[model samples]
Target: MISIVLIGTGNVARHLFDTFRLYDKINIVQVVGRNEQALAYFGQYSKTGSNFSNTEPADIYIIAVSDDAIAPVSQLIANVKGVVAHTSGSVPMEALSKHPHKGVIYPLQTFSKERKIDLKNVPLCLESDQKKDLEVLNRLAHLISDHVYGISSKQRKSLHLAAVFVNNFTNHLYQIGKELCEENNLPFEILNPLILETAQKLETLSPCEAQTGPAKRGDLSTLKKQVGQLKNDRLIKIYELFSRSIQMKFSRD
Candidate 1:
């Protein structure tokens, strides 16, 4: 059995805790965090505490805190013999350099406490300074996920940037779509089929090949009409910017 001490009580930590508890091979030794209220959630399942100086001995210490807090939190467990890994996509493994056995276990998916995610489908990116630690992390990752990858810190940074463009920026665009639908006295759910189809198309078609719309076709009249329909200056600018970017990308093809 692989014993784990999970640090942090945020979305990622909560999701991991919920998933790990289901597996018989994994034993959650303790969960440490600064917030007493957040710690209470984990207290029901395992040992919980705010004191980082005195933590339970485990085979792996997973720090699921924010990127900025990773360094300081890692320092608190520098003397541990177990592998110290941070769950961050953009932050480098060196953030846990204080510990001799440092690594990264980044889950490439957006996490929310309310949403139940099938971690088996979520991609797990693993990196470690030590070979033995990597093996251990691989074993743990495989227990929950089928899609596991060995990613370098540099590659992980690039992947994270791409994720921002695809996930975060795309979600903001969806909000804009929702507002536009509301203004037109239409339900935002009208776009659900289009959104689903677009996502499903990626399974077989490359993003460039999946490209469509007035912007990609270079339909100036349609584009102008669509831009003119928007009353908000910010929305108009965003629409124009995206249209120009899409046109520029496909024009070379």
Candidate 2:
């Protein structure tokens, strides 16, 4: 059995703990965090503690803390015999330099404390300094996910940048779309089907091939009208910038 100790009680940590508990092959030895209140969520499943000095021996110590705190937290457990792995896409593996065995297990999916996701579908990116540590991470990753890739720190950073554009920026645009619909007295639900279909198209066609809109077609008349309708200066500027970028991209094609 692969014994694991998860550090941190945020969304990613909570989500991972929930998924790990379902697998009989894996054991959640303990969960540690500075916040006693947040650590309560893991109390029902594993031994919970706030002090780093009290951490028990485990096969792997997974640090799921914030990007900035990863280095400091890893330093605390530098003496442990277990393989030290972090769940960060952007942070470099060298951040765990204090540990003899360092690795990364980054899940390429957005996590929310309120929303539960299927771990089997989530892409797990694994990296390790040694072959033995890589094998250990591969075993753990394959147990929870069907899709696992050996991604290096450089490649993981690039993937993280793309993810921000696809997930974070796109969600911000959706929020803007919702506000525009509400201001125009149109039901925000009207855009739900369109949004779903746009995402669905990516399953068969690449985003570049699935692209269709006034900007892609260079419909200056429609673009002008759309920009003119937006009363907010910020929205107008955003529309112009995005339209210009789309036009430039397709024009080269």
Candidate 3:
């Protein structure tokens, strides 16, 4: 079993730790962070401490901190004896170090402490300085998931950008829907099935093919009436922008 030392105790770090417990393929020897107090509770089972700076390395050192902290944290991890990796979608693999066996093991999913990652289904995007190191990453990935993909840093970044639009931006729309429901004294849970169905449908149909709306149909009367129903100024503006974009995309005029 690969001995892994996980760094960072944030959302990603916490999720990865739970994944280790679920898979049982890797021995999580330690968890490190810059803040001692922050990592204290996690140490109850595994070895944990402060100091992003490396004391000793195991088979793998995974830095699952924020994207902006990637380089600075890696630089602090001195005296690493094994392959080092980070979990970030947009960051490049080379940020680790040219001398060390560096790689990126970025999981393409939104992680929340309350929501557990179904490791058997997560798609891990991996890249490395050498083919052999990639094999190590692939092994670790396949231990938890069958959906490992070999992606270049460039493609990973592109995919990350697309994810921001689909996941983050789309969730904001859902929040707006929830707010509207609350104002109307409707239970937000009422939208759960609709949301799930919308996601399921995209698996079979392209978004353009699945598109269903007054905007897509160019129903001018319905579109105008729907905008009039929005009480919020910002949402009305957003509806206008999206409507224009959708119309332009479909109509081309």
Give the alpha-carbon lDDT of every model. 0.94, 0.94, 0.85
RMSD of each: 1.0, 1.0, 1.9
lDDT of 2 by residue, 162-215 (tens): 999999999999999999999989999999999999999999999899989999
Cα lDDT over the full model 1: 0.94
User: Model 1, residue 101: what's the lDDT?
Assistant: 91
What number of backbone clashes does candidate 3 have, counting pairs of residues 3 or more apart or in separate chains?
A: 0
TM for candidate 2 is: 0.97
Candidate 3, residue 155: Cα displacement in angstroms equals 1.3
Q: Which segments of model 2 are wrong by more than 4 Å?
A: none
What TM-score does each of the candidates earn?
Answer: 0.97, 0.97, 0.93
Clashing pairs in 2: none
